[model samples]
Target: MDKVGETVLEIDLEALAHNYNYLKSKLLPKTKFLAVVKAFAYGSDMVAIAKKMESLGVDYFAVAYVREGVLLREAGIVTPILVLHPQPVNFEQLITYQLEPSLYSPKILVEFLKTAREKKLKNYPVHIKFNTGLNRLGFWETDVDYISKQLDNRDEIKITAILSHLAASEDPDEKEFSDTQIKIFKKISVALNERLGYSPFRHMLNTSGIINYPEAQFEMVRSGIGLYGYGNSAIEDKNLKPVAQLKTIISQIHKIEPGETVGYNRAFSSEGYRTTATLPLGHADGIGRQYGNGKGYVHIKGKKAPIIGNVCMDMIMVDVTEIDCVEGDEVLVFGQDNSADAFASSAQTISYEILTAISQRIKRIIR
Candidate 1:
């Protein structure tokens, strides 16, 4: 492939491996690891990242939709993929590719069983997601008995695991709430297992949960952002290496006079003579308009270049008066020198949103 045009996401496979081993060290020796490769593995290449994780010995892989799993399967990924939020329409394809579904509700369980029966497939592996307070998806604690009773006689679908999402695992102020979630998850799993006369893998830890609630590692843990780098805390972040870096080049440079405006709506007018650079990327590439008007910045020659005007659809003007930069100078959007977390904080968002929001149109290169 040609050298990437304007911007590219450089994916460091070694950094990815470092993060995996870092998180794995937090788990008990026998606990299993599931790399959450959903959202294109946090906006890195899904096939490539999944391939690396598979080679690194991840016990399983997970994706938010069935299509993501299908993509990996098509790329020859043989790891057990758990579809976190599978729609009923794709259940057939899910089974055909041996991709497991996180059956969270009565509708899903019943429909999956029905689908399995229709296809004459037996012992199809499926996971159950419980609503342990996140209340986002999954069966509620009160629904455990119902789930057990419904699956008691059905041999067509096999329950391979029971899992839950932590509501506020990273927030230290919500430790009590997180503890309650863990307790509720344990109770539901134990009750459901006793009633069903068998046990499956039971886990309830996310990236933050693995760090904040290690004792509750259960039989396995699912990691997402941490695998890509940000640990949601300064202390944890120090030990992890970011896997992706967004880079671009200064396409053009302009000298603005006092009272001269830069971009749309004249959002940034120069108070005095100022040097500015235009980068060939804008809100359309996942850098939202909210980052305009000096709210965000980029690194030019290791110096800060603040966004000056309203971020345009395909370009952004940044004040580079302090930096002696020219067209074609390298710009670091976020990576080793500029933290994605800090950049998102400037936009009043989180790192996950910024990282995953990166436009898929950007080329990804794995090192």
Candidate 2:
């Protein structure tokens, strides 16, 4: 817990363990847990986070691309990984790494089958994704018959699970819609099981779905943000601990007089004498331009200092007129005390966007 000398993202493994256990507690005893480690584990050191989760006995891991899965494998991760949105070009590499692909479309399925057959593989594990309501990826419920036809006599791939995503599992107003999506998924699962003459495990719940709808736990549950310490609701957020804390040091202090401006294009003109502190992180560091001009604030010595003027590519100035902090003082961008959700809310965004938008250049300190 030493003060940060430079911009760094402190990752707390203990907090991660707490979040993982909290989310797992919501599932049934027999249900499996799949931890999503894509986007660099929500921008907090993917290999480190995956290694921690693997040690915690995670049943499976999911990534958005085949390269992510390969990275985990190279990092010595042996857990089965599902490439959520794999492309046909990576089929060979995906198979080489023993990474399972979620075949959502007919074209992808056929292409992957061709690759598997060409390799003379038998019963390669794969997951079938259905479009319950997300509309982003996955096969439609009506496509089950087509899927069955494609795999009719082919034994190159085996269906390990059938899964879908919930569009609005966190919104109370969308309860009916979420329920309907679950029903459709159940229908599709039954039909696919009957067609294949075998039942693959089924899963549809994301973090919020796990919180709001326990009845639809199916046979496995997937958690991404929840394991990263967000529950999509205030009530549940309290039970989880934020695993990443973005911290930096004040690079310099400025004294602004009336009519004086700050940052590029003179975005802010001081109305009165004020003090400002420049931080060594900005748009290039994942603090987007939208957070400029009083839209975002940082915590300096427990006081909120509103950001002023345009955010620079490598620096941002925050008004610290009322604070007693000076150069080299540690500044908190977001942490357990000031959650990422609260920080993102100041600029009309969500925790997921800000958390995942963090740049890889920032140093990560694992505790």
Candidate 3:
């Protein structure tokens, strides 16, 4: 716990395992689960998180880029890696590491096929991403026929799975929108299978999709946020548990008199005499500046301390006038008492953004 800095991110592998098993229980017997480890496992120590997930017999692992896949491969992760958004430039490295690429466009598919053939590979496993609604990256439904025609000519590449991203699976209120996405994905999958002459494993449901539409759990399910303990499931599913805890220590104390301005730009003024605790963390460590001026808080000695003034790059002040805390006292930035969910709510964001935005510079202490 005492290794590098005052501010550290505590990662509980036990909680992670609990969350993993909880999600596993929701899957059908024949369904496969792919753990999404992209963005450094939601910015909570990728190697450690992947190692823990791998040890728990995670069926598959997913990363957003080829470099992420390579990192896992270098870390001795032999699990099937699905590169969610791979580039053609990394084709050789991906192929060398036995990494599977998600072919989202005809250009990517053609380039990947060319690379596979040049490498003298056969039936190489690759996932086909269809753009049902997300419209981020994927082959459009209208482009399916063209893709199938190209695949027919190229015998080197094999379509291992057909997948898609759900746009509004998290919004329980948007039932019709979610339903439309699911239906479109299903239609695309059917058409793709018929055109390809073989039915590969089809997976469209991400964590939210798996939670909201269980019947749409084709052959596999990809879980990202849920595996780390935030379920997008429309209904309240008490199965998932949060795995990361952001903690810091009060490094110093300051007493401000009435009419005194605090921090840079004089963003916050003390109306009365108040004691403030200077925590050794700030915007540089994922505590955004938006949290300043009493908008955000931290738990000091189990009491809420409102953040004061403008957040600095490496430090932030919290009004702890009522709390009996001193220098070096542990402060809960986001955890048991103040969950990441709650913190996100206060910051006007979601848990995913909060988790993924945590900078890599912060010390990650794995438990």
TM-score for all models, in order of appearance: 0.98, 0.99, 0.96
lDDT by residue (tens digit), candidate 1, 1-367: 2244579999999999999999999999899999999998998889989999999999999999999999999999998999999999999899889899999889988898899999988788889999988879988889988987887777898888999999999999999999999899888878988898888988789999999999899999999999999899999999999898999999999999999998989888889999999998898899999899999999988999999899998899899999988898789999888889989999899999989989998888888
Global lDDT scores for all candidate models: 0.91, 0.94, 0.86
lDDT computed for candidate 2: 0.94
What digit string (tens of lDDT, one per residue) describes model 3 on residues 87-181?
99999999999999999987898899889889999999999998888889998888879988887767798898989888888787888887898
Per-residue lDDT tens digits for candidate 2, residues 213-301, read 99999999999999989999999999999999999999999999999999999999999999999999999889999999999999998
Collision count of model 3: 0
Per-residue lDDT, model 3, residue 60, is: 90
Sequence-dependent TM-score of model 2: 0.99
Candidate 2 colliding pairs, count = 0
Which one wins on TM-score? 2
Stretch of 10 with least lDDT, candidate 3: 232-241
Candidate 1: C-alpha RMSD to true structure equals 1.7
